[model samples]
Target: MGPRNMAQGSSQKPEFFVNPEFITTKTRAIADRKRENTPVPRFTALVPRGHTVPVLNKNTLVESPDGSYRDGPSTHGTDRFERRRADIVAAAIPVLNDQGFKGMRLTAVAELIGLRATGVTYYFPRKEELAVACIESGFAVLDGLVAEAEREPDAGARITQLIALFTARDAAVRQGEAVPLASFSAIRSLEGEHRDRAVEGYKAMFRRVRALLESPELAAMDQTDRTIRAIILLEQLFWAASWLCDFDIEDYPRLAARMADIVLNGVAPGAIADPIPSLTAPARPLASRDESKESFLKAATRQINEHGYRGASVDRISASLNLTKGAFYHHNEAKDDLVAACFRRSFTIMRETQIEARALAAPEACRLAATVEALIRFQLGPEGPLLRTSVLSSMPVEHKTEILGHSYRISRQFASMVVDAITDGSARAVDPMVAGAMVHAAINIAADARPLAMAQAPDIVARFVRPIFAGFLAA
Candidate 1:
């Protein structure tokens, strides 16, 4: 997106609008292009064309002079290759973090760095090939941090570094879908070698943490259990970065401290400190007590978002706000009505934003980009968590249908963007409806990513989103 930057040109690309009602077709076409091969996006950004050849990447192994890698060598790269790989990643991660890998194309990567797509292919031939390059680059960076820990003899410092990496991502979760939007697709539908590597990577991560946490005093603790616990906390952080997008550790200081305490001090019921005392207070109706309806709804919304509608009892919501049932019911007919209100509020905002993006842009790409960009911002931004909560999880059939209808309208509105991209034959593999659905899938992934996890990366978001649109954007 940076460097020479063709993708983020001042000029617009294209646009289409989907209906907010029923899905008219089981399959829809967005764009169709001739099966002619085009130059792939090379890692070279903003430099003029040259007679360069594609070299060492995913399938090819980079070997050192001595045959074996350095003292703490990672699986990929020699010293020269490592530097080049880092350069490629440095130039490209923003694609994932900003547009999402799905949305980002190697062409855009080349344009950002001022080269032709063929030049990009010179670095790595296939899209998946570059994808692997990008992934290896990310891991290499982590490897450096781990290597630093190895340099330190003290166990505490090593453990701290491991924990630090858990919370650290490419950037602070700035945009709502910023962090998780890109990676979510892979996480959701892991397959092939990438899937296997991902699983192994996580396991390796835990093993490192366990290794660091070991000490004479901690000898009695089970490293396997400790690693498991760390993974759970890491998952929570992923939620925070992906959903909340920007909360610092302090917002939930206790969460981090509690985890550390648990990890350091065993949870042998005897060894653990007593949890904060639970209230023994009896529930009362809102009418019998005094509390504002605004307060009641606010409390309910938070509960529903966090604990879920089914898991969050009406009594709990009312009790949380210190209100009685009658007072709570004074403003609404039933919980269904309240949920409907929530859904309506969210749907209206989504609908208006789409219409606004369309209104602000022009015919072809700009119009489409405006709409897609707006959707991207919303899915990753403040509306992210609320969007997830708006879906009627564990609700009754009628309620679930109503909430889904609300979601459908929002989704249908997005279909129009795909239509615009397809009309121009702007991107590769551009099927307007399929692209639209893929966008939905991308958003769903973002919704599931927690803040602390790797998903809270703006670069990763760009990688995913941009590639997706790259597939949709007409040449």
Candidate 2:
């Protein structure tokens, strides 16, 4: 089936897979620790130590020279405390983007706001609580955009408005006009109440976009296809916050409009483009045990990509490769170690393909186009698996931090290529960082775009890259 058809039609939208739930007894134990005032083990990546706890209830209302209060919470006292928390969250936004949920540190956030870590921690007792606040603040901004988009009388205009809103809001956040919030991508790293809130925000956004995509004008499109397209569009928009700072501040509206156009019509210079090619069959088998190990990795990647890390089991992955659990254990000591290996493999493949593209003797645009095509083909090929970093969240805290460092390095490499392209005049002048992020986002979302497989890789790459770069309409 095509990527479009991969979306299973149902009255309910599918829930994204989360990390495996803790054992009932273990969960209870943790709750018991909380009640007993004993320190429970927390993910080091999610919560760093060494912050001084704030003294309770210092409600002084001294006035500062800048007309701000010296001491007070936002609602009760003088609103100074609330403003301080807001400032810390803002500083933490870029850190969250750079370090991700698992890697972000309260010390880093405190440094950003020129406050001691203890001062910041006084307001937020736990890192999870702070992260939750940031994530929710971001959603509030996004929800406002969606609400405004809903005001459009024509359903056709809704999508474009949303795209523009996302782009502009991202710009506003970067400029410090608005508070910083974690992108929806951070949702994977959250658990418990934080995860629940983030999930609700995502579901609401999905429903609105899905409804807009199902308009009469899009009647020719299947409902499932529409759902998939909406997801693709949202991914592109949500990732905007990462790169918007790299571009000229004034270009947001135009860039947003271009993005909307590309999402809706696609970047075919003239006539409508043909569909991209799809994967046909699995890779050929080998006899050696070494080959078996490789096979297990590939199958494991695919299984994880299809069903989240929690859902994909050793039995299922091994079964797909016609191997026993013994064979699986032969290749790896444990699932956590195996998954970390899988992530390394995925990053290595992508980095290698990108390096090869750069070595090609061609114009920068052509080189970029080649790299994009190669990556997509690899992602859809028998050996190709989508780069789902959600795997990082399921691993040990130490592993999560290590993998995140590697991912950031890869992203910088991508940004470097974009900078080279813009400087060489092979691509339009935009924020290279933003452009690079958009490319990564596209590749990530395309994994589920099974429909693209029906077309050739070059054509598919062109269709996908065109919307982001050349845009759909000609000047």
Candidate 3:
């Protein structure tokens, strides 16, 4: 009447088996019971693999978005059953495409796939697995890009190649903002460290941009810190190009140039007389193939920076010379390739401008001030807003975060310029790094300062973009 025992020789009932007859007296009931317990699959232990986020697990998973296991009995799971979940993904992909990570819902996917919620649940007993698949697909897309970038000649060329590999206009057209949009969505869905990882990867994109900008002719800084400064400047430009949404997308080139100047040249020292002019692009005679290439790059920069990546089509690039896609491809491989080329050319112009500005500064303070003016010019200029929308919005969050790392260096460069000015009787001597960081921070705050005042926005944005920078440098 108490604890039931099941031994070969004894007559007892196995626990959970209501019928004592099932506990055969002819077998070793203890050994059987122990074996059964050994194989008892713990339902509570069925943590889904793709259970990355509630967003991915609950929303994106089609088959078993809510499926969780139970260790109680063999009431489910078919070894032969592959759990296709195609119906889930088929319907899910469109929603995911449109709304990104947030749109994936198992019930919705089930409704679209013509499966009952339970029917869908039967295959996936857990929503996590389905999310894992979705995540896998995302990674597959990323891997494809990494593989394509391998064909690049050097780090500089590799960035162009890598960017082209993923950010091509054709890719955007084919997928309707495929990689960029999806990644942007995924980043929004991911939480915490996972989000951070995405951010770091995106920043690497800028790292490549910096490498291209810091090429032989433009790179005058032999010091590691200066090189780091250049990298930071490129990062800021890369981010401003990729994600600044409040403004027109075309200004990316101007933005890049000014940012480059700030990092490479530092601020100019002269007193304030007038707002710097939004100078017209100089006329250049592109004659030889080399010149033609340069011109193409320059023109391409102007176009993409003005129009977002999607807006700037292959035809647009070729149309400048009445050329076709074939002709464009003859010069560049793909639209993304062209983007990389455009970025490089933009950096080239910016570098040249920065070098000139550095030379023109009458005092060291003037030089430092020049650096600040150059940065502001691009953002306030016509090209700034356009480039902000077009090129910058296309990059993923991971890429944007990486760009910020480079921007840190630019802040130091600004400070260094101030130091130089003060040393040579140009301006007062002070903490160069701190002063530069303040100005650089102001520029960054303004870069994405729309829809809300960076000075008085939501907590995260406000805390992140505190605009006390100008005051920091005020003499």
Q: Which candidate achieves the best TM-score against the true structure?
A: 2
Tens digits of lDDT, candidate 3, 1-475:
1011122222221111111111111221221222221221211111112110101111111222222211122233442232234224333444444434433566655665456667657754544344334443343343333334433444344333433333232222222222121323344344455455544544443343334433454344233322233333333423432333323334323333333333333343233333332222212221242776775675665455433455456787788768978888887867766566454444333344345556763665554445444544443333341123224334445444443344444545666666776688664434454446545544433333232232232232222211122210112
Give me the runs in candidate 2 sitting further than 4 Å from their true place. 1-78, 114-118, 174-176, 219-222, 240-246, 269-384, 389-440, 448-475
lDDT of 1 by residue, 129-175 (tens): 45444444333333333443443445544444333433332122221
Report the error of model 3 at residue 69, Å: 34
lDDT of 2 by residue, 1-475 (tens): 0001112222231111111121111121111121121222222221112111111111222223332222232335445565455555556666665566667788877765556789878977787767666665554445445554655545557777777656654554444333344555566556787677656756665776676655555566555455545666777775665455556877776677656655554332221122222222222222242665666677887777655565478897888888899988887898877777777777766676677667766556556566666666666655666557644544567678878777767777767886776677665555555556666776767665553444344445444455444442211
TM-score of every model versus the real structure = 0.36, 0.53, 0.33
Best of the two (1, 3) by TM-score: 1
Q: Rate the local accuracy (lDDT) of all candidates.
A: 0.40, 0.55, 0.38
Candidate 1, residue 475: lDDT: 13
Give the distance in Å from residue 145's predicted Cα in candidate 3 to where it truly belongs.
36
Error of 3 at 397 (Å): 13
